[model samples]
Target: MRNLLMKVSYDGTDYNGFQTQPGGHTIQDYLEEAIRRLSGEQLKITASGRTDAGVHARAQVFNFYTASPIPVERWCMALNTWLPEDIVVSDAMEVPMEFHSRHAAKRKTYRFTINANQYPDLFNRRYQIHHHGKLDIAAMRQGLSHLIGTHDFTTFASRKSTKPSHVRTIFDAWIEKDTSTCRPGTRDQGIIHTFISGNGFLQHMVRIIMGTLIEVGEGKRQPDDMKVILEAQNRAAAGPTAMGKGLMLWEVDYDIASQEKHND
Candidate 1:
């Protein structure tokens, strides 16, 4: 058997997330089905992580072992032929037998988009969270600063998680606004995009972070209080978890050896 790594991109609007569910459609279900049909082999695939419903991914990684002799490019084409339009295989290649997509991943970056404006644009509504209230950008930035570095993020994760450890090193966390458009259209309205890059993330961690930052921006919470919340280690102390629609798995970074193994 040969190990294959796939770089997948999906719009998570309709599915029940990345993982396979018994009765629900998912990005994984369709992906595995396509692989089965194309390779004529049953394979179990593993992803870097699970993304909740309505959350999109730009470059999610997964790996599977197959005995088929299909070319790497053919794997991409064959899978796309069976997969839905929202999910596409951007790249696929054989990897070293020891390479595991989840274990080999070095870091992940996520982007949460907020439509900080009075009106939402219809075209981009599905991908961003729309809020009309005036937000204090300075306070939001201050709140996010506290989240950088290593911390036990139990307060920010969902109760459904079963991970043994909540300690994660956030290499970077910051918020930025796109004010490029000087135009006065609804589409040109400024947006606050939160970028979080870390060694790993717990379930709902990013969403809760976004929610708490939003509260800080709205003057509902003090930026300095984030340290207290982090120390509390209780989910209730954190702000409401933001909707999953606005979160996107922006990128997955891996070692060069892993990349070469996949390409080979």
Candidate 2:
């Protein structure tokens, strides 16, 4: 048997999430079904991690094993034929039998978009969280600066999280404006995008961080108080968790040679 790795991207507007559920559509369900149809092999795919409902992914990774001799390039085209419009297989290739997508990942990056404007755009409403109140970017920046480093992010995680450890390293966290107004259909109005890249993330970690920063922007919380919240390690100490729709798993990083060899 040979292992195949696929780089999957999806618009999470309609699906339940990445993981499959009984009587529900999921990214994994479509992927596995497509592979089964093509190779007539029952392949079990393992993803790097799960994204919550309404949270999208630009480059989510998954791997499965198959005995078929289909070429690597054919994987994407064949899968796309069976998959839904919202989900697409961007790249695929055979890998060593031992390479697991979740275990081999080194880092993952997620971005949360905020539509900071007076009115919400109908087209982009499904992808971004709309907030009418003016946000103080300087204050948000200050709060974000405090989040850059290693910390036990228990307070930032959702109370429903089942992860064993809350300690994770955040290499960088920052807010930036959306300068790309060149898109034809997208509303180029007032939009603030928060780009956060970390070594690892707890459940709802980025959303909670965005919420805390939003509070700071509104003057409800001081930027320096972020340290207090992190030290407390209590979920109640953190701000509200942002909505899941605005969150996107942007990228997944791995050892290049390992990834290349896996894609061979």
Candidate 3:
């Protein structure tokens, strides 16, 4: 058997989520079916992590052990032939059997996009959330700064999460104004892009953080209140969970120097 790693990107608008469920269409379901059809074997693939329903991904990594003789280089083309258009395998590589996608991931980056437009963009409505009024970007930045270090993130995680530990380290967090598609004097100003990279995330963590930051932007909470919320270690201290559609799994990082490639 050989271990193959693949990078996948998908628009999650129509699916239930990344993981498979009974009678529910999912990214994993389609991926597994495509693989079974291509290789004539049932294989379970391990993903770096799962994205909730309506959450898109740019570079989600997954690894699977297969006995098929398909060339690693052709895995992308071969899988694309069977997978849907919204889901694509961008690249593939043969890796040492010891490499597991989820456990080996070092960091994950997620981006939450908010269209601060009075009127929604017709073409990109499915991928972004629409919010009215001018957001205080400076205040949001200050609130976000408080999340840049290790802390118990219980305030930002979903109450349903059963994880034993809510402690996670955030390496970086920032927001950018994307005006590339904006036109001056138009009702649309720009989109607010929030990026957060961390060692690991709890269920709905990023979304909760975004919601809290948006509240700060709206002056509902003081920027310094982020520190108070973090210290509270209570879920009720955070704001509502932002819509999942606006969030995307931007990237997953693994240590490149530690990777060992399989001999072709």
What CA RMSD would you report for each candidate?
2.4, 3.4, 1.8
Clash pairs, model 1 backbone: none
Q: What lDDT tens digits, residue by residue, belong to model 1 across residues 176-260?
A: 8987632575534478899999999999999999999899988999999988899899999999999999999999988957567
Score candidate 1 by lDDT.
0.90
- Candidate closest to the true structure, highest TM-score: 3
Per-candidate local distance difference test: 0.90, 0.85, 0.92
- Clash count, candidate 3: 0
Model 2, stretches more than 4 Å misplaced? Answer: 179-189, 258-264
Say which prediction, candidate 1 or candidate 2, comes out ahead on lDDT: 1
Q: Candidate 1: TM-score?
A: 0.94
Comparing 1 and 3 on lDDT, the stronger one: 3
Q: Residue 146 of candidate 3: its Cα lDDT?
A: 98
Write one digit per residue (lDDT tens) for candidate 2, span 1-264. 788888999999888889988866888888888888888988679998889888999999999877788888888998889888889999887767788888888888898998876677689888899887777888888888888888899999999889899989888777878745434554344678888888888888998988888899889999899889988999999999898899999999877586666667
Better of 2 and 3 by lDDT: 3
**What TM-score, over all chains together, does every model reach?**
0.94, 0.92, 0.96
Q: Write the per-residue lDDT of candidate 3 for residues 171-237, one digit (tens) a residue.
A: 9999889787777787676899999999999999999999999999999999999999999999999
Error of 3 at 217 (Å): 0.8
